[model samples]
Target: MSEQFERLSRLPLRDDLRGKHPYGAPQLDVPILLNVNENTYGVPDDVRQAIVEAVSREVVGLNRYPDREFTELRTNLARYLGHGLTPENLWAANGSNEVLQHLLQAFGGPGRSAIGFPPTYSMYPLLASSTGTRYIAGRGNEKFDLNAEDAAREVRQSGANLVFLCSPNNPSGSALGLDVVEAVYEASEDAQAIVIVDEAYAEFAHSGTVSALSLLAGRERLVVSRTMSKAFAMAGTRLGYLASAPEVADALRLVRLPYHLSAITQAAANAALTHSDLLLANVENIKVQRDRIVAGLLQLGLTPVPSDANFVLFGGLDDPHRIWQGLLDGGVLIRDVGIPGHLRVTAGTETETTVFLETLGALLERAVS
Candidate 1:
């Protein structure tokens, strides 16, 4: 008989991701990059100094493991979140990405299902599949609005164990209103499923948008995942925290490896918290830039989605890929969302935005001619 290993090797991998890269658009070495939605600013000098100071004191044993519980970091995070954080109610991961994975490990797996709304973050389904969970998508309304009723119906019918919602949703830059989010939360409550509001872009949204934390009061099953990647400008540091009820937080901790965060990373994140004022200042700048860019796009005859986040999405170009390439060749790089004729551009510095607009103008002129 043929070797049993031969059959195992031939078996197909997960069907959900027949052919897909885990992430979109590899980072290229280009000037004026407005892709990936990173904060266009760098960590403030004061914050950098704090990082240097935190690690400057040499410990007795360099080989000793970091605090597995990350008590100090958790405390700082709790303080940062203002109301929802407690030592018992929060956890940190290598990144929000890892936090999401841990969630999948805990609540998702073979035979269980997770629901996401698309044209949202691409990672949700990918994470679900990697953990052997079935992934279901509820298409958004024509204007990319969250159809919470439809999503709730899907969850009820599919018995999904988790529901992921991204506020100021990725790619589209449209935020779900409070009523809609609350409706979904209420719907998921009976299913005993978790509702995760990924607030990666929350800091940039204008005030009064519904933060998941607002609804978290007394709600044990809701989780809000946040990252230092955007407003804090700490993406490379890979520090993210989740706010939830102590029990849910404990569940996440159980699934994560001990000491998942590095001493240096924890130090960096701690420093980031202290200088949040500086970060908020940058956020204000980005908001102004975002508005200016949106106005410019509208004036150019492109229809930009109303955005409360740090980026904007626009359509009406004949071929978005060609326009993206043209902008790239012109030394301005923006993301070509796979959605037909749409592109997402992150807010950058005034100078970079100026160059981007000029380049985009020339490209549109060429296309029109």
Candidate 2:
């Protein structure tokens, strides 16, 4: 082999992910997929038409590179947010995942640390590790509620430069209290650390909880990340956004790739924003289905976490893997949360939910016998 090839083979990658794949969950061909928390509904016809129109209008511009700054999309997004957001306070990326990665690169690095609340999103720790920052987890309370006091103490102790919180948290579907989030924000102030609230499911929880954006009046270090992937039925489109103070937005821009978002994606996202009301209606339907599922699980002697998101988590099954496999064999796929004895099931259409519950009933009866 050539000397260059030999040198490449000799270099070892970072120890944090020596032999790891970044993404979780394997892809499977199934009739009904309730595993990944995707909105079961398809995009509305009006939104689809708008996207077509947007793409048609932008076709002429394809010969040249897209707007590196994504000016129009940023301005439109800021206006849509309607809570003190301006173009200067907005940033867009391939997805919220990418926005998160930019934040890590901007605020986390060698000799620095970031804090995460466990049984939350799995990506936070992975992102922190990838950026060469120390990742620490503070366990959530009994109800899966974030312990703000403990979080603040740990951040102060570790001198962490970033803290990540996910409302309507993944796998558990519990929304963190606004007061707790604000407390953590205040505690991180002295350390000059950034507080990121991932509001990926905010639309689903719109009826009750206050968004982190609503609490961003004087907080310069707080950043709120949202995605169109959840309630908007556009996970395949890959559009995510961040709302923050202008200074923090500037920091994210500095670390993100130039032209990180494509013109096509920007157009699709803008189109989707215009049809948010229609999307919310779909969310309402999913919420109804979620409630039904939760009640059904309880009847089967399972305890489900109270959820505001479009998914539910339940306990009582001894081996979740067996239940997961049984559901798959019955043509319904649900998520096997890493937490032993617990499983997460995303809300599908009314009919799909019915099929899932019927299948699960049969499986549980067999297990009991």
Candidate 3:
């Protein structure tokens, strides 16, 4: 297997992809899994039972194709989002990544470019590359924050046909202000670009952090994408959706394959939506633990970025990879997100959080001694 995989890489591949690595986080089996920003709490028993019932109902209908447009699932998603949206204003796929790929396919291609403000979600650039779109690197400040002015400047300068902004950004966890979203949308007017706000982590954001969905009222060029993978505790279900103008949703239809969503997937997500409140009950608890992580990292004299998501990114490490390995050796798994001198850990359950903090504290103490 290893020899064949190595040979495959050496085969004639896309020149741009020749030396590039695939996107992945270490999937180690550990006592405490604080990587990947998954909800530590599993699906509630009530929601699980409801989903099972929903899926069972669709079993006999397996011979038929899922709704080509997934009407019922879209309506349920619209109801969950609650911005006076209808199925016309929604689109969904196996994951937000696919939803995003649809957008790029419709608006971006050879000779057109897309821009993403980094240390953002790594997939934005990868998506651009895979779709035969030029990837333009946009800048964020030293603290990895992108203000309205800088964002507007990058959009205008890059002449980007698509722009991606990840709020409660991964590896940083800071939420982008709505003002930034508005500014970037306005800036992209000349380029006729589509702006995508990847809010996969929005449910875990601190209160008062507004979603870009609020800005979709008049902005036909704006898209706010979300997923069930994070706070919804439905990562394995793989349902992601986006909200935009009805016209934008129509554009996505031209690019998406027919019957892209499986009947089982639609049933599972719809049933989960019916029990939305119960599924989201753990959000506040996760927020509490996220705050605890920030405070605990501070007490250890590390520089932890203030986060609006379930994970915390911290710096001031002499060797981030070494510390990551040390934590893994202690049976706690976290992410070393290629950021020099920094590491990120998800806000796990209380006991898991305790194990992570205790293990790291001991390591820090040992280093100091």
Whole-model lDDT values for every prediction: 0.83, 0.86, 0.91
What number of backbone clashes does candidate 1 have, counting pairs of residues 3 or more apart or in separate chains? 0
Segments of candidate 3 deviating more than 4 angstroms: 1-6
When summed lDDT is taken over every stretch of 10 residues in candidate 2, the lowest stretch is 1-10
Better of 2 and 3 by TM-score: 3
lDDT of 3 by residue, 143-218 (tens): 7788999999989999999999899888799999999999999999999999999999999988788888889998
Query: Per-residue CA lDDT of candidate 1, range 62-146, in tens?
Result: 4878878888888888888887467778888988989999999999999888998888888898898888988988665557877
Question: How far is 57's C-alpha from truth in model 1 (Å)?
Answer: 3.2
Q: If ranked by lDDT, best first, what sequence of candidates would result? A: 3, 2, 1
Candidate 1: list runs displaced more than 4 Å: 1-20, 58-61
Error of 2 at 39 (Å): 0.8
Tens-digit lDDT track of model 2 for 281-317 = 7988998999999999989889999887889999988
TM-score of each: 0.93, 0.94, 0.97
Residue pairs clashing, model 1 = none
Winning model by lDDT: 3
Using TM-score, rank the candidates from best to worst.
3, 2, 1
Give me the overall lDDT of model 2.
Answer: 0.86
**lDDT value for model 1:** 0.83
